[model samples]
Target: MPKHVWITRGLAAIAVGGLLAATACKPGDGTSGAGGELDGVTLTVAAKWTGTEQKNFEEVLDGFEKDTGATVNYEATGEDTGAYLGPKIEAGEPPDIAALPQPGLVREYAEQGALKPLQGEAATALESNYTGYWRDLGSVDGEAYGVLLKAAHKSIIWYRPSAFDAAGVTPPETWDELVDTTSRTLSNAGITPFAMCGASGWTLTDWFENAYLSHAGPENYDKLADHEIPWTDDTVVQTLTTLSEVWGEDDMMKGGQKGAVQTAFPTCVSEVYGQEEAAMVFEGDFVGSSAAEAGATVGEDAVAFPFPAVGDKAPVVVGGDIAVAMTERKGVQELMAYLASPQAQSTWAGLGGYLSANSGVQPDAYADEFTQDLSATIVEAGENVRYDLSDQVPSRFGATEGRGMWSILQDLLRGSTDPEGAAKALEKAASEA
Candidate 1:
């Protein structure tokens, strides 16, 4: 979902050219001075970021270049990064680095020797900046292979302040209270309370993930993600039924379930901020940008709050891109180290539309009050943060369209299956995966 932005290519990047420079030094070595350690290095880094996100990342790259004198080429792989990276890697010509989209892919590539093991300074940087929760997401078989360069806190609900004021209802802190608020907003203000992104399968998964994490607790969430328990387990059935409490309500979704199934992801954000506005849309923090596109000013015209507590604690479902080294080339380890440090992530953190897993990054480094609070929320959560379950699971069971979590949840939204039926279908898909 972090990559699901309105991306567009802007200025051209340095082409994959020039010679591979020799390793002059590691991070903090004297060679980073003028005529720098990586003076002649040309490192190629590939990812799915473009548009403003791309522009912000280039600023991070510019800093790396200035510090190390490395000439880095930027490669945008669009949505289908594997299609672009797969052939290049198979031909024994992988880029120096790539920002893998999923934790599962990081493990697969690490197991297959497609990814190089990050050692020494890079590993140390990762451990120092991030908690075990973050470090483990980038490691395989007890070895670190990736660094989470960008992060997203997904358990956020964006709403119109005017809608809440009109209804005289404050944001709720508990699930039952949220359910009550939704009804009150509709009854008191004649507002449609929720904008559903049923058409974007991943958003539905996020909904389920938040419920599962809070209701079943983090340990069970981890087990379910690893398939240690079947999808048909009671916890999953209970979570699905909980989701239906809202989905089953005729007036809960802005256009009802059918229309929700027809709505794309961004439309869900805009529908809450545009004329004839709905009261709310529940998604990741990325919705802030989509709200802006709808002519809504973030933290003013629109505001976000933590997803209400479903059980004893609030759930934080994190989504992010992990930087992985594909080869042990000169300047690669140094770049990896920099990315794992607060210095690199903070560069983009102030530029907006980004959060860093690096705890060393101070909350004040963010652009505004909303971002500062959001960044602080993530850092304070420490090892309590969990990565996206769908991203951690096998793609066949997690991401495939017309099957897996996407199809099952979409079917659930359409009232095509009951909670138990949805659980069974998901179990069948996971077994196949």
Candidate 2:
């Protein structure tokens, strides 16, 4: 996922009334003390958030502290959490709880016996607040080890509404229509149709994953993610060929293949907003914030539609954080339970820059109508949502640096590798990994 910039204006303040009505108890509803009821309980929580993100999170943590009378020490663990926490776990001094960003990493830690299973109130809270899809994402084998804290809808196309109106084009409903629409936008409107963020290899992988999920369906997607089906399988070949229809075209992309392969993710959104070099960019909802940062008005100048269907139905690919526990202390369990509740999720949602999969949370909890609509779309998808396939796989085969999908797909974007060749290379990489 790209680095996110939150829109803080017009956010609703924390609604203690709503929180009280939604949950069984406020942290220290009846208890009274200097530290409240949970006095002297200090939890060490870690995550990959820093700066603005960390500050925003602390606001929510502060609410928890006031309600429960417990203190939380938050540590910004950076992106490579495995490396950061491995030594701590080895030394038997892991944080009480950690907000892991990757479901794959959570599963890895669970299998290594480095995590505690959610039980009693925490388990019940998760089961009540989240959907089956979200709960399943946090589970490894048959037990729940983590709980999802935030979610991103990845199957979306962010476009300039004015550009679409100028081109006299409505968002396409099918893959064939999308191709035709792109051609018409280029020819009639005289604007580049799509901004391909090839410089950021993850964006390219997202393109392939969405197409593959729509065409091959969810079962095949799962098989591919688990490597039960090799990347050289026909499904992968078909997906790459489908992607190449647009990606291979010389004029369909902003700067052609060369320019696209050099354009970074932020630049891709800016091209659609600031430069007006392209009409649309395919990415997650996070692009809306990026567009806003570049001086484009979200929900007006920039808007999005669900990615057009490639087969029978459009698939929603999701990226999110999964909160996992490192210890089994009672306070740690309480904190995990709180984080899984609608109250905790709603507080963060009201602060902007956050989206929760907690079904119990009201749509209006979001900062703006646009974000509320995005939340509704995710709810509409329901069980149809799929975790990002690349992120679900091992990093060696899925991540950017070195010989992963990033390098392989960049070659495809440069027209240096055909669909078949790319499939073969992907299979080889997976096998080696």
lDDT of 2 at 421: 99
Tell me each candidate's RMSD, in Å, in order. Answer: 8.1, 5.4
Where is the poorest 10-residue window by lDDT in model 1?
Answer: 11-20
Worst 10 residues of 2 by lDDT: 1-10
Q: What TM-score would candidate 2 get against the native?
A: 0.91
- In angstroms, give how far residue 328 of model 1 lies from its true place: 1.0
Give per-residue CA lDDT, model 2, range 294-392, as digits (tens). Answer: 889877788777777898888778888888999977578778887887777788899887777776677778877667756655554655678898889
Report, for all candidates in order, the number of backbone clashes.
0, 0
| lDDT of every predicted structure (CA atoms) | 0.81, 0.80
Return the TM-score for each candidate structure. 0.91, 0.91
lDDT of 1: 0.81
What residue runs in model 1 are displaced by over 4 Å at the alpha carbon?
1-35
Off by over 4 Å in 2: 1-35
For model 1, give the RMSD to the true fold: 8.1
